[model samples]
Target: MPEENRTANFGRGVFVHDVVIVGAGPVGLFLACELGLAGCSVLVLEREPEPRSPWKADPLGMRGLSATSVEAFYRRGMLHPLLKASGVNDYPGADEPTSPRGVGHFAGMSLDPAKVDVAALPFRLPSPAMEGVMSNLEAVETVLSERASMLGVEVMRGLTVSAITQDDEIVVARAGEHEYAARWLVGCDGGRSTVRGLAGFDFVGTEPQFTGYVVLATIADPEKLRPGFNLSPAGMYLRTPAKEYIGMLEFDGGAFDRSQRPTRDHLQAVLRRVSGTDVTLNDVHLASSFTDRAMQTTTYRQGRVLLAGDAAHIHSPLGAQGLNLGIGDAMNLGWKLAATAHGYAPNGLLDTYTHERHPIGAWVLDWTRAQAAVMRPDPHAQAIQRVVRDLFGTRDGTTYAFEKISGSSIRYDLGSEQPLVGRNAPDLRLEDGTRLGDLMRDGRGVALDFSIDRRLHGSAMGWESRMRYAAGPARNDLGLGAVLVRPDGIVAWAGDRDPDREAFERAASHWFGSPAI
Candidate 1:
C-alpha cells in the first residue's frame, strides 16, 4: 500500500507516538536510529514519495565524514557497512601506493596527509577508522534507514507536515488531513523547513557572498576544461573524476535565486567565466545552485518542537561540514531526548542540546564564512589565500587545519578540568580484545574501570540500567584509571588514579540523572 494512503487511514485520529521526526534524510534517519536503539517509539514523515535520486548517488552526492561522525558510526556499528558500500576500505593508510588516500581540503587548498603531525592531537585514539571517509549521500541515507528499520522505526513517505500545534504534554503534527501526536517533534527537514517555519524559530545569520553551482551534464568538447580543480580570475571550478559532474563557485553576492530551475546555457556561461574556457554543455542531467549565506536558529528547541540538521543551521558546503554537523546534532540530542521521554532526564539535560550544539554550529558557520572570504576573486582575498597556502605547507598549520576540519579537536566544556573529560573517549582496546566502541553498540553509558578496581562499579550501582559497568586492562590507558563514557561516546569524567567515588557519582548524576531510588 502507498504510504500516503496508509497515512490517510489515520485521518483525524489521535495516534500518539513517542516522537515524530519530520524529514527522512540522513539526519532524521540517524536520529530515529538512535532513539529506536534507546527504546523510544519513533515515526518519520518524509515529503518525497520515494528515496532514490540520481543526484544523490556518487560523484555528485559525495560527502566527507568527519572523525566525530565517523566515531559516532563506529560506536553504533554503522561504519563498516558504509565503508564497504563506498569502497573506502580499499585504502587503509596514506602510505598505500596503489590506492588513493583520504585527503582533506580547506577553501580549495589541499592539505597533504604527509604534512599533518598526528602526535600533536593528544586525545585521538588509534583506530581502524581513518581520519575521514567519503560516502554518497544516498548510501548514508540507505545505511541509516536500514538501521532504523532494524530498530523498529516507522517511516512514512509522501507525508508533508502542513501544520503543527503543541500543548504542554504533546505535539500534534498535521500532514494534509492526517494528524500524528507525539511527546516531541523534531524538524530534520532541509534548509526550507516547514516545521521550523511553523514552529516560529528565529533564524538569524549573514547573507551570501557567492552563488555556487553543482552540475551534471555532458560536455561537447571535454578538452575545453581542465582535469582537476582550477582557480581563475572569476572563481573556482572542479572537474571531478566522474566526467559528468562539475562544481563551480561564482562570487555573485547571492543574486541567483535557487527557486528557479537551472538551465544548461546558464551553467555553460558560468563555467566559461570561472574556468576561462568556452565549455559547451551539450546535455544537462541535473543542476543545482547554492550560496555561502550562513544562518542558524536562535534556539534548537521551542517547547515540544525541536530542530536538527539543515533546519537548525545552514552554511556553504565548502568543507562538507553541513552533513557532519547535522549528524553530530542527532547524536548529541538523541540520548538526552530519549531519557527525557522515558521520564528520567535531569533538570537541564534537554536544554543542553542547544547549549552544547549551538556553539559548534556557530563555529562551523564562521569557518565557512572565513573560507568564502578568502576564496573570493578579489586581489585582497587572493593575497590572503596565498598566505594561507604557504601556512598550509607547514607542519603546525597543516595539523591544525586537518584536526579542525576532521572534527577531532572538538571538546565540550563539561565543567571538568580533566584532559579527557568532555572529549571523545579514546577507542581503548580491552584485554579480551573487545574495543570500547564495540561495547557502545547498544547505546548505553559505560562505567569503564581500566584497572579492574570495581570501586567505580559500586558507585555506579544505582544507575545500573542506564550505565553498564566494565573493568579490564587496556593496551594503552593513557594514564587513566577509570572513565565515564556517555552513550554518545563523550567522556563525562576521567581519573588518573583509583576511582574518585564522590566525583564519579557527581558526574554520573550530572549526565545520567539521579539513580533509581
Candidate 2:
C-alpha cells in the first residue's frame, strides 16, 4: 500500500499517522525515512523551528560514523549524497579491501591505523562503505531530511510535545493547542529529553566523572597548546586543525555548572589547568558543555511510545559512539516498527527491537565509562592508562579496539550456533557483479542462494513482498551456500555446502511471517 493511502481519518476530524516521531534530528529523520520507505505515514515534530544551527555545522558539530553506520547509508542508497554533503571527494578502494584510513581515539588516546590487522577481522568484504566517514550533524540530517521529504514524511517544526497519551491502539501527542495522533510514537530527542520523561520511562545510569567542553574561541597564543589530542596529569585537551576549535576535559567530578554558558575567563582557567599552559582566550564564540554522566532508559519502549538516539542512551562524546549507536538503533527498529504498523509482522517481532538493541546500548555506555575511568586525573587511573597505552601499542590491541570502534564486533545472540547467523551480512557479491547492498535499497529481507540449482527460489517466492531472492555463484561465498539477511542487514541464518530449503523456509517464516499464497 502507498504511504499516502495509509493515513486514515478516524471518524471525527482526527487523522492518525502510522508513526509520529519527536525531534527531527538525524535519528528521528532516519527512522522517518525508513518508515516512509516502507509505505508508512510518518509525521515528525521538532522543537526547533529552524534546521540550521551553528553547533550543527563545522568543527563543533563534527562526528564520526562507524563502518557499520556507513554501510546503513550505502544499503539504503544514500551513500553518495551523504559523502558529497560531508565534503568527501570519494571513498576509495571499494573493489579491494584495505586498512582503514583512520582509527578514532579511545578516550583521548589516538590509535595508529597501520597497526590494525585488517586480515584478522571476521566476515569483512570489499565494499564502498568499508571505511568510516567524518561528517557533521547538519550534513547527516540534511541527507536524511531530503530522503524523508521525497518519501512523503511530514515534518512539523517548532512543535514541542507537551503531553503524550496512548491507548491500546493509538497514541496522541499534544503541543500547545494542537494534537497529533498516530498509531505509534517515538522520541528521538536529545539527552535532556522531554518525551522520555513524559512517557514515564525509567532512566538509570552512573553520575558524571568529568565535565567536558567544546569551545570555538580566539586563542591569543596559538602555539601555547599542542595540536591534536593531549593527555596531561591534570586532564585532556584537544586542539584540532581548526585553530579556534578546542576540546577540554576536567576531572572536577563534573562540577562545572553546565546550566550557565561557559565564560571566556572560566574556559581559559579550565584550559590552563588541563593543558598545563598559560593559554588565553581573546573571545569565546561558541561553547557547549557535556559530562561523562552515562545514562540509559530501562526500556526503549513504553507502551506505544518508544525512544531512540540520545533519548534512549547518553554518554560523553568520548569515542563518538552516541550518534553511531543511535543510528544503529533507528536502523534496527525502523523495519520492525514499520512491519508492525503495516500489520504483517510476525509474532514477537516488535519485542526483538529491545532484545537486540538494549545490549548494544549497554555496551556503549560501558565503553564510554571505561574511557572515562582511564582519562581520570587520579593516580590509579594514571597507572591503568600506562598499561592501556602499552596495550594499544600492539597489533592485537589495535585490532581489538578497531573491531569495537568500527562496530564490527557486534553480534546479536539469535539462538544460533552458526557464527555468521547473528552478524551483519557483509557486502556479499555475486559472480554477475550484483551486491547485497544494491538489493537491500527497498527495505526488505533478502535471501541469497549461492547454490547452482537456485534451490530456495520457490520458498523465497512465497514471501516476495517481504523478501528479495537472488541466486547465483558468489565471487566469495565465505564458505556458505546461502544466507538469510533481515531487512536491517542482520544475517538471520546461514546454510552449508548444500543449502536446505526447509531450513531456509523456517528462517524466512520466523522473520517475515507466513508465506503468501
Candidate 3:
C-alpha cells in the first residue's frame, strides 16, 4: 500500500481511453455499453479475476427491474436478450396488466395491485416494459458484458484501482504495476468504491438502523417456516417463492460483522430467533450481510472523476431500488459523458448528470430509512405498521407507493411547466408501424412531431447527426403536437397544436446546443 508500490508505472505505456470505468458489475458494464454505443473508447477495470460468485448467480442474486429500467433497456434493444437469458419470456401480469398481484414492496408492505390506478400513469403503455422483471445478477451482468464487448469496449479483470489522480487534462488511475489514463473516470465499484475513496469524494448520510441478511440454506423442517414475508417479535424474515431463499432483518443497529463470511451456526441462530421456529439448517450455500446504513457523496463528480451506482449512494435493499437507481445513473450519465468526451456537449450538460440524479438518490435513501423505521420491532413501529398496512389497502396509498417504487413518478426539473416535459416520454407507435423505442436504439436525441408540422421538423434540421427528426401520426399523441426526447428517453420539450419557432429553437439549443451553422 506504499506510494512506491502504487506508483509502479507513472507514465510508461499508459493506455488512453475516452472514459475509464472502474468495476465490471451491472452498472459499470451498462455504462460502458452506453458510452461505447455513442462511439466513445471505454475501458472497464475489474478487481475480481473472474465474474462469478454464489451471491451473484441465482436465488440471492435476483434483482427486480422497475418500469423505468425496463423501458430503458427496451429503448436500447437490450430487453429482449435479457428476458430470453433470464428465462422470463414475459413479465408477470403481462397478459393482464390489471392483475391484483403485487408488483413491488415498500419495506415489508406490498404495493397492492388493486389499489393502483392505471389511468394515473398515463405515460405507461400496455407493453411488458411497464412491469417489473426479475433477473439474476449474473445474467444481467453477462448480457451487459456481451453487449459491451460487441460494442468494442475493453475490460481488464483483476485490476484494482489503488490510486486515482486527475488534473485539467486527464485522469490517471494506478492498478498495481500499470497505469490507465482517460479523459473522465467513473467509479461503479459498489459501496466500498476505491475510486470514490482514492479520489477524495465526501460521502455523508445516516447510520445503520438494522443488519440484514440474504441467505441460501437447506432447512430440515421447511414446514415450520411460513411462506413469503413473515414478521415476528424478534425481527422480519422473508422466504422467496423458491423456498430455499431467505432474508432476515435484525434491529441490531448494524452490529453484524461483514468482513468475515457468515457460518451455518450463526445463520441458524438468527433464522430460529427471527422466525420463532426450530428450523434446522442442513447446509449453508451462500450467506451475505447488509445494513440500513444510507450514505451518498455530496457531489457525484470531482474534477475528471465521477461516481455512480453504489459508489455514489447506498442504502438497505429494502424496496429493491438500489439496482434500479444505479441503472438510471448509468443511462443518464453515459450519453452526456460521451458527448462531453466527443466535444459535442452543450454547456453544463455533464453537470446535469449529478444535479438530476442526486435528488433521486437522496429520495431513495430517505425511502429506505422510512421503511426501516416502520419495520422496527417496537410498540410505536408496530402501531405505525398497522396504520401503514391499512393505507396500503387503500387506492390512493397503493398508487403512491407504485409511483415511487416503479420509478414512474420521477420527473426532473427541466424548467418546463408541462408535466410530460421532464418525464419519460411515452412509447408511441408511429404511422410507419414502428415503435418509438425502436428508433432510439442508436442512442441519440429524438425530435418527435406528431402533427406533421414542417416547422417542427425543420427545427431539428440544424442539429444534423446529433438529433434524429421524425414526423408521423401516432397511436396516441396525448394531446401533444410534438416533443423532444433526450438520449436517456426523458422529454426535454413539448408543445400543443400551434408551433413556436423561437421557443422551439430555445429548447433545442438548451439541450442539443445551437444550430450547426
Candidate 4:
C-alpha cells in the first residue's frame, strides 16, 4: 500500500535493517548520519513534509552540541551547501555586510565549519574535508539526509510511523502501508513521539510557567545590534514611546500563536517591564507562540525499541538546547546501535543507555528549570538567575558544569573510576600541532595514545589501535588530569596515573567490544 492512502497496523512490520530510525527531524537525521559513519547500515523514516518548523531556519549561538555532535559534523564533511541552500543572502548593503553580523554571522556560529574538522562526518565523503558554515534548519537536515544516503543509509521520507514492536532479534515499525524491520528501532521523533506513545512510556516533566515572547522578524541593520544582548537574558526588551524591541526568550511553556498579536501597548509594556525601554513599533512581520516544555522520558530504551532526541526529552528552547540535545542523543546512541548490530556489544551494554541518559536528562531539567524559575517576573528572582548566569559564564569550572548540562561537559562514569570518567577529553594537539578537532576526519571514534612516560605498562594501554594515546595535552581545556574517550565522545576514564585495567577494561569492552585490545 502507498504511504498516503494506507492503513497502519499496530503489530504489522516488514523488512528489518540493522537499525531503523523514526522521525526525520534534526535528531533522527543526525542519528542516521552518525550510525552510517560508525559503519552501521541504517534506515530512517520520516512523516514530515520537510525538516524544521514553519519559521525560517534561525540560528542562535547554537552551543549545547555534545562533543559527540561535534564529532558527527566533522565526520560528515558537511558545510558549504547547507548555507546557500537554506538562505537567500541578505547583504544589508555593502557597507553593512556584517551589520546583521550578530544576526547571521554569530548566527552562523552554530554551523561554523571552521570550528571543527570536516572529517568528523559520520560517513566518508569523496573529499577529505569541507569548511563549516551556518545553514538553515531545513537545509542542514537535507544535507544530513544526503550524507547518510551516501554512507549507505536507507532513507524513507514522508512516512509516518504508527507503531513499533520487538521480536527476539529485531524491532518492527509500521507507517501506514509501509512496514519495516530492524534489529533496533530508534525513535528520534519529536516531543510528540508516536513510538513513545506506542511503547506506553511516560513523558514526565512540567511546562514553562510563564509567557515569554520571541520575535523572528528581521531588522534593517542587525549589525548595529550588540552581541552583548544574546550574551545573557538581561535587558531583553527596550521600549520607546513608539517602538519596542525585546530580546529572545524561551517559550517557557508559553504559546506563540500567530492569531494572537500583542497590542502595541502590550508590547511596549513588556519592553518597559523587561528591558526598561519604550520604543515605537513598526513592521510586525511575524509573531508566533512558544512554550518551554521541560519533560523527559523515564528511560531511553525498552527491549529492541529505543527512543532518542526529542523522543526522549523536550524542554525550553532557552539557549537553543533542544536541537543540540537531540543531536547528542543521536551521537550517543549511534555507536552503541552499530556495535550491537555487529554483535560486539556486551550483554548489558544496551541497558546502560537508559541508566546514563536518564540521569543526564533529569539533571538538565533541574538546571534549565531553575534557569526559568529565576527569570520570573519577580525582580529578586530574576536577579538571582542573572548572578548564576554570570557565575557560570565567567568561571571555567562553572562554565564546564553548564557545558556538562548542555551535554558538552558530560563524562560517563565509566567503571575506570578515573577522575575524568563521564567527561570529555581536552582538545588534543597532533604531532604537527593541529588540534585533535582537526584530526576528526569523519567523526569516527579514535583512540589517541598519549603516553608521556615509557614505564607505564598496564593492560588498558595495549589497546592502542582504537585510540590516539600520546603525550598529555600541553594544556587541558577540560581541566582533566587524564582522559580516555568512548567512541561517541564520552570519557571512559581519566587519571593521574594508569587507570585500573580491570575497571578500564569494563568500559572499553563496551566501546571496543572486547577486553583491552
Candidate 5:
C-alpha cells in the first residue's frame, strides 16, 4: 500500500479514510482502483470472507462486455490483462474498424452481427479494445482486485455493514464491533443493498412478470433440447455450449418459491414446460432464480453516502446488462468522485455523477422491461416478438439494436451540440503511434491538441497535475483539431480546425477546477 492510502488517526482512536466502499465486487473494486490511481485513500468492505464462488466461474458465470466497457479497461491499461484472464489470446480486428462477431441477444432472439453497419456508429475508431469479450465474473473480479491492490486500495472481507451514520465532514460504517470512517461512503452492494436502505434511498420500479432460472444439471436426454437460445410458446430455454448449464424462463408471474432450493423434479418440470419437451433432469448440481422485477433508487446519493452498480438499480439479467451497467456506473463515477475527494473539483461536479448515471440506469431497467414484455408467452407478446424479429432482419434495425446492446449509442448530454463532445472519445492516435488509451493510464484528464502551432500547450499547463497534454497531427482527426477528454474517457470538449485556446482553457477550468496559481 502507498503512504497516501494509509489510514490516518484523526484523534484519540478513530481512523479515517478518504473513501470507504461497500461490497468488494467488480464495481466496488473498480471504483477503489480509480480512487487509488488518483492517490485517494480507499478501503473496500465485503460480506463474503472469500472471493471465489462457483457462480462466478466459467459457464454459469459467463458475461458479455460491451465495447464501451472494454474501452474502459483499455484506458486504464488493464485491457491485455483482462483479455488474458478471460482466456482470449487476442481480439480480432485491432488495426481497422469492423463489425463485431456477436451483437448478443434480445428477448432470447439472437442477433446477426453481420447486419450491424459499423460505418453508422458515431466516430467509430479502430483500436485493440474496439470489440467486446466473453468473460466470467471471476475473471473480471480477479483482474480488478489485482489492479486495486496495485493502486493501494485495501479490501477487507467478512465485514457486513450493519449501520451507517454520517455528517457533513465524514460517514461511518458500523459492522459488528468495528466502525470504519471515511470522508465519503459509496454502496456498491447488490440489489438487496443494506446501505441504500440504511441511508433512506427510495427505491421505485415495476414488479416481476415471470420467474427466470439458471441450472447446472445432468440431462438424461440432452438431445431433446436444441442448442443456444430457444424461444417457445410457453417461455424460453437456453442450452449453452456447456452441456450441463441450462437457463429457462417460465411465465409464472414470479410466483415460484425461490427461497427453497429448486429440486430435480421442479427443474425437470419447468424445463419440459418451457422447452415443450420431456427433458429429464437426473441430478441438479446448482440452481438460482431471478425475475424481471425492475427497480432503482430514486437518487444515487443521500448526503455523504452514494450508491453504484446494483446498489443503485436492478433488473432482470435479460440482455446481460447488469454487469456492464454497473461497470459503466463505476467508470463514470470513479474519476469525478476522486476529483471531489482531492478538493480540486468544480462546483456541482459530484452532483453530475448522479445526473449522468441515473438516466443510464433507468434506461437499462426499461430495456429489460421491454424484453420481458415481448417474451410474456402470450399471443400479443408473440406478435410483438415477430415484429421485432422482422425489424432485426433489416440492416438499419440490426445496427440500432447493436448500438444499444453494445453501448455505442450512449452520448451523455454534456450540454454540447458538437457531435463527439459528450461521447466516449474514440481511440484517437497520433502520427507518433501514441493512442489516447496509453495517455489515460495515469487517471488524468487528457488534452489532445492536434493543431500545427501547438496552440493549446501553454493553456493546458495551468492545470498540469489534473490533465495530460498531448500535441501532434492525428492519424484521423475526425474533423476536429483537438478534443478534451475527461479521465473517464468522456469527451469534455472539442475544437474545430482553427482550435480556440480560450474555449479549451474554459473547458479545462470547468472540469479540473480553477487554474493553479
Candidate 6:
C-alpha cells in the first residue's frame, strides 16, 4: 500500500469532489447518500477491507425488491435498527409453499402496492442512506463508513481501481498506489466491473436460469419453524431471523447469487425439502454463496465513468428486481448526478442513465424471462407450473405483470412530458397531514402545487422558491390530479386536469433544463 503511502487526502483539504464513488455497494451507498445530500463532494472507492456483516456478501435481491425501496436505504442514517427492521411484516403468505410445481398460486394474483392505482401508499421514501446501505453488508459497511465520514464523503479502503485517464476535463484515477482525480466518476463496481472494464461499457446480457445453492440460515425456533418456513407456491421465504437461523434462501433465480449458486447437493436437497417428513439437518447456524447474474449496461455513462449497481445490471433473482433496480439506480442517478454536478443539469442530464436505467434493466430482464419461463423442468413446464400455480395464485400472471412492469409502472419514455404523460405521481395520502412518503423527505425536489386542479387564480409564490410546492385540492391520496414533482421523486407533471402558468413553465423547463416559475 505505498504509492507515497497511499496518497492520504480523504477529507483533509476538501477539494476533490462533485462525485467520485466506486463501490460501497447498495448502489454505491445510495450514490453516497445522494451526492452527499446534493451539496455534492463525494468519494467512496472501497475494495471491502470492511463493512456489511453477519459475515456479509450475499443477502440481497429482496424477493420482488420493494418495501418502498426498503425505506430509501443507503445505510438509512447508519442503521436505525436497520430502519426498525424495515417495517410491516407477517412474512410470506399468499398461499405458502406449494411448488411441487405450482408457484404459490401467482402469489394470490399479485397486486398489493397496498392496492396499486397510483399505489395506495403503504409508506416508504425514507432512506437513512437506504437503511444504512442495507445494513449487514457489514451494516452497510458501517453505515457507509460513517456516512463517508459525516457526509464529507471520502472512503478509500484497500484502494484498488488500478488505472483510468480522461483529460479534456480531468478524470484520472489509479489506486493501488493512489493517483485519484475527478470531475465525475462512479462505477458502483460489481458484476465484475473494473469500472465497466475500464469504461469500455457494454455489459449486455444473457445466462442464469440456475446456478444453485442459496441458504441464508437463521432460526431460533421461529415459532418452531412456522409451519415449515411458510412461502412456497414455489419461492420466497424470510422472517428476518432474530437469534438463530431460518429467514432466507434463494435458489435458482433471485436468491443469493454465486454466479447462480446451488449444488452443495442442491443445497442439501433444499435443506431436505424444508426439514420435514422427519426433519434433521443439524442446528445449522449460517451458510454462504453468490454469483447470481443478469447483466445490463448499454450505458450508464462512459466519458467520465458511471456504472451503478452490480455494475449497471446483472439479473436473475427474478422478481427480486435486482436490488429494486439498484434502489432505482440510486434515486434515478442521484438527482441526475446532482443536476450534472450542480451546473443545474444539461450535460444532457448525464444522458439519462442510459435513457433511464436501460428500459428498467430491459424491463426487469423481460419479467425475469417470464419468471424464467415458468421454471421449465419440462413436463409441459411442470404442467404449466401446475396450471399457473393452482389457477393463478401468488398473483401468477403477475397481474399481466402488474399491468406491464410495476415499478409503480415507470413512464419516462423521454417524451417531453406534457403532464407527466402516463401517470405515477401519486405517492398519495396528503391533507397537510404529510405523506407522499412524508413529503419526499428532503430529497429536495418537488413542484406538485396544482392549485389543486380545476384551475384557479395564482398562488405559487414563485413555486415556493424552486421546489416542494404541494398545493392540495385537485386530488391527493391516490387520486392524482394535476401534478409536478421532480427533486428525484420523479413524475414531473401528472394530472387528471389542472393546468396553466404556460404549462407549468413548460414542464419546468423540459424537466429541469431551467426556467421553472
TM-score (all chains, Cα) for each model: 0.95, 0.98, 0.95, 0.70, 0.98, 0.33
lDDT of 3: 0.85
Residues 1-517 of candidate 3: C-alpha lDDT, one tens digit per residue = 2323222334655656788999999999999999999888899999999898877877878998887887888888888888887888645524334533556887676666877987776576555476778888998998898899999999999988888888776788999998888878999999999888999999999999788898888888889888877877778899877778889988889898889888999989999998998899999878889999999999999999999999999999999999999999999999999878877678999999999999999999999999999889899998998999898888888888888888889999998888888898877667686777887999988887887655687677788667788888877777878878889999988988665767778888888776777
lDDT of 1 by residue, 252-364 (tens): 99898799988887888989999887779999988899999899999999999999999999999998899999999999999999898887898999999999999999999
Model 1 CA deviation exceeding 4 Å by range: 1-13, 91-100
Could you give the C-alpha RMSD of every candidate to the true structure, in order shown? 4.1, 1.3, 4.2, 9.0, 1.8, 18.4
How displaced is residue 496 in candidate 2, in Å?
Answer: 1.0
Clash totals for all candidate models: 0, 0, 0, 66, 0, 78
Write model 4 residue lDDT over 408-475, tens digit each, in one string: 44655655555555654444544455554444445544444344552223644644544444444333
- In candidate 3 the C-alpha lDDT for residue 285 amounts to 79
Candidate 2 structure quality by residue, lDDT tens digits, 139-207: 999999999999999999999989999888788999979999998999998999999999999999999
Q: Per-residue CA lDDT of candidate 6, range 1-517, in tens?
A: 2222223344433245566788877678777877777667777887867654445533432233343354454213322534434332323311221111111112122333322222222222222221112223444445545654676777777777977877545476788866667678888877777888887887767765444333554333345444323434333333334433333333355444445434344454564453332223344444555433567877788887787777877765545556667767877788777776666565477787778777877877776666656654445655666676553433434333443443545666657545445334434444554445456655665655544443522433444434566666532333444566676566665544445666666666665666434
Evaluate all candidate structures by whole-model CA lDDT and list the values in order. 0.86, 0.92, 0.85, 0.56, 0.91, 0.54
Task: Kindly list the per-residue Cα lDDT of model 5 for residues 1-517, writing each as its tens digit.
Answer: 2344445554526778889999998899989999999999899999999999999998899999999899999999999899989999868846999989889999999999999998899899988898889999999999999999998989999999999998877899999799999989999999999999999999999989989899999999999999999999888999999999999999998999878888889889999999999888889999999988899998899999999999999999999999999999998888888888878889999999898989999999999999999998889999999999999999999999999998988889889899898788999999999999999999999999999999999889878888999999999999998899999999999999889999998899888999886
How much lDDT does candidate 5 score?
A: 0.91
Query: Which wins on TM-score, candidate 1 or candidate 6?
Result: 1
Pairs of colliding residues, candidate 1: none
What is the Cα-based lDDT of residue 44 in candidate 5? Answer: 96
